[model samples]
Target: MKKVIVLISTYNGENFIREQMDSILMQQDVEIEIHVSDDNSRDNTVNIIKSEYSDKISNLNINKIGTGAAAKNFLQQLMRLSESDTFDYVALSDQDDIWNPRKMIAAVEALEKSNSKMYASNLTIWNNSDNSTQLFKKDFPQKKYDYLFEGGSAGCTYVLTRDIVLELQQIIKNIDYSEWPNFSHDWLLYFLVRNLNEKVFIDGNPYINYRIHDQNVHGHMNTLSVKMIKERTKLFFNGWYHHHALHYKKLLQSNSLEYKILDNFTKSYFSRMGVLLKYNFQLMRDNKKFLMFFFFTMINFKTPKDV
Candidate 1:
């Protein structure tokens, strides 16, 4: 009898929005309501939702910023929801994915049956062009850096407990999304949940059918193992690595209690800002992941002279 609300952020998703909505309405073991925050879709995305699943929707907010900021869109959706305590849990949904009938049931059961404050499950990625399906990733992640370098899991599969939802509302008031435009909403939440020692449940079974296409924002899911070592190396060497680091730092700074706790992690995690910000390969010796520091930048015979 758990009450759950699915927060969906939609763009021009008319092609599959209706089919997805049907699957959402088919979820079991929970009372469900859908609240969509659409980023001013020019197509019939809103009309499709209204016409196809009017009974399934709870709230709809239309935004005109047209920034196509999915993270900000969802963050705002969560903020709007934080004002009330009507629901027991909240799940994230992408407008285009088809949900398994038991998605909500498994998520709620996993959290209630255990001490996990948040829930994320594996999904089968469906390729549109060729119509192929594959596991999002073969392994279940356990490390802190895994959450960073490799996103812990798809954000769309998250079912957050009430406490997690409350903290999100509190911390976001001080966070500026512009600071890290590409910083992932899922990774940010996963980082805090782990660092705060909040119990997290990661179900191994695939629960949703995640869609992958040329236009997907985070479409790196071609294989279970991230075999793109070259791309990963670029991520480390490029300023993106450090930029992401700063993104976490800024969020941590916003919550004093959280920041104080994060201060307890290996100091190297906090001290790499200089190398990251400067993209200084010569300072690789200063970082714990010297190879990564080197690979991310200054990968040649000699490192940059420290300035």
Candidate 2:
């Protein structure tokens, strides 16, 4: 039996915590332990976790940290753990999703079959507000820089092998805080894996009921219409896109040749029609508008090319 440790981050999930735990405890064909970090939830999240799952779980650790975003909470949990052979795989969980009984089994099987270090799956997005549901199904295109602009694997669906868990632990041991992105540990992990040239497997099977409520962190469903594209572009220039673009502009300067292409592309596309010459641009220099459209669309939304 494979041993898997799930790292869950909770803020205020009191209502759904018990149901989520029940679903996880019902998982088949694995020895599962849960380690949750509660970010100072003002609700009864911690009490409910203790009452429902404290005795059921093989290993349960519920920590109360400062109030913060999910990224910080997850990263802290990862950084604090030591390298160990205690578990064969480490999976990520959210306070709100219900895992299918076969989710862990399928993730482990996919990693073995692909000979990869990490695994993730398409999720069933359950919009609670509208009572609508859809499958977030897409195959992994296995391209470079897909992780940077497009977060390849949704964090909650992630399950990393022992090798990858060790690699990330080592990164934390020697990470440069100044170079860290202020958000999205999922995207940063993708960058690290791609840089290492490790094979990543993302299954198309929907394995979890991903809840979409008003409190969703990043998994909002949006139609890919042209008007939505404009809205996404506006959002791109507004926050994460601009910040990460500038971040990559500096990071790519010292990275591989493919990244230099990304850097030049960024500068030229952000320009109107003149700054192309200023950027010493080659390879995707022309078609600035189309490039912008593609870049923004990919960065802002998901494509088959994404992870």
Candidate 3:
């Protein structure tokens, strides 16, 4: 029996929303459902989620929006409380993470034994000032053409698939919020469900106690310095190259043969250079080591996995 809906979203999560609502009401079996959308959190985090989820919660009030507009207004109030109801899954909580009572039963047995419509797990980075734990093992790269430049897909350890959240609510009702790309809302639902291949990657440990406070943004972009890491690495690679050139210009306006061979070999290797464009046409391009690791990752190179 599947009917999960742990969708959360908040702002001032009053001291780890009651240990993430008692590890999700001490999950034992299933039939879960808890939605809380509070962007107006002037602190008590909406009176501790209305004194602890006032009867299986369902609150929304995107105070002064923006955080992907309070996650597209909490996915349009969870698609209007699932209209005439139906919920095989729709998790994406993070009011100060805690999960892992088999994190929604291992993301519903890896999205019902993977045909891959969406699933995510393997996270445990809980450092709350020294109560350490760092697991982060989400391995997926067995390469199905490297899932067309894999980004997003870790919105607080995901698990979606009410038909991929109604096909991301019809791609967020034809998105164009000023031509998008402010990035977030799990990288725009991991760039439209991994470019419609529907993505899935579960391994284990869904417990993500990642409440390393100071109202984390990108979890303290590696304890900044070196000139705020060269101005936050050129504003995080110019907002990841404007959301990877707006998802590779919507995969070359949907003509997609892997973005027409990665946009004709990244526009013929940035119009030629020396050494046969450095070791033969960008190493005979076929995801040439992720386009020379995204060309020293869009110029602002400096690693330690660039935090």
Candidate 4:
């Protein structure tokens, strides 16, 4: 039996933590350890955990920090513990969601059976108001290339082997997966692992109940007004454009054909060409004002400058 570490990241989640914990505690197979990284919640979260669970849980406090920053800090703490020993796997958890009893066992079996570095499963999306639930399964392309380009996967579904988790720890120390442009840490992890050609697999099991409510940052953003949509669309375009350019720029700076190919081929789409080109061009201009300056300095005055 593999010893798995359940790494749950949370903040102000008093309303649903007990349900999530009870589900986890009820798992029948394999040995499990629980680690809670609390984002310095202002409610009865910590106190409740202490009173109910006692020493069965370990907690990390990230008082007054962003979710991304809190996750990074908690992972760093995990790294410190890792110097002495290793856990068979690291499973990402959200405070508000409830895990099915078989989640951990099934994920472990899937990882061991396939020798995969990472695994993500389908989830049951639960609506907070009407008690409606839907299974969120992805119909990804059979080819890895297609999956990389069509990159929308659920984060709370991730499970990583020791080696990949450690490698991610190193990569995140430098790149900080949480801060990647409105992108979920799961998306960054998926893209990074895929970029490295790591062995990743997805299973068709709805072992998690993804609770949706108004307070969720990402969930709420999806229902904004048309005007808000336009503004956020512009922001998303700008952010993604800069992110891709920086990614390719790193590849070029490193002079690696492997990364360059991955970057280029992953983004080669005809329909999105015009929009991506505009974004990439603006990204370049913003980063390399000197190049823009030199062009004007070298060329003869063409038309009256916008003065």
TM-score of each: 0.79, 0.80, 0.29, 0.74
Per-residue lDDT of 133 in model 3: 66
Following a full C-alpha superposition, what root-mean-square deviation does model 3 have from the true structure? 17.1
TM-score winner between 1 and 2, please give it. 2
Q: State the TM-score for model 1.
A: 0.79
Deviating ranges (above 4 Å) for candidate 4: 62-81, 146-152, 176-179, 220-235, 241-307
lDDT of 1: 0.70
Stretches of candidate 1 off by over 4 Å are: 138-141, 144-150, 220-237, 253-307
Models ranked on lDDT: 1, 2, 4, 3
Q: On residues 127-176, what C-alpha lDDT tens digit does candidate 4 reach at each position?
A: 78778787665524334333232333566778888888777667666653
Which candidate number would show the highest TM-score if scored against the true structure? Answer: 2
lDDT of each: 0.70, 0.68, 0.60, 0.61
Q: Model 2: which residue pairs collide?
A: none
Using lDDT as the measure, which candidate wins? 1
State the TM-score for model 4.
Answer: 0.74
RMSD of each: 6.2, 6.2, 17.1, 9.0
**Per-residue C-alpha lDDT of model 1 across residues 66-171, encoded as one tens digit per residue:** 6467877888888887545588999999988899999999999999898788898778988888888988652353543344333447889889998788876777
Question: Which candidate model has the greater TM-score, 2 or 4?
Answer: 2
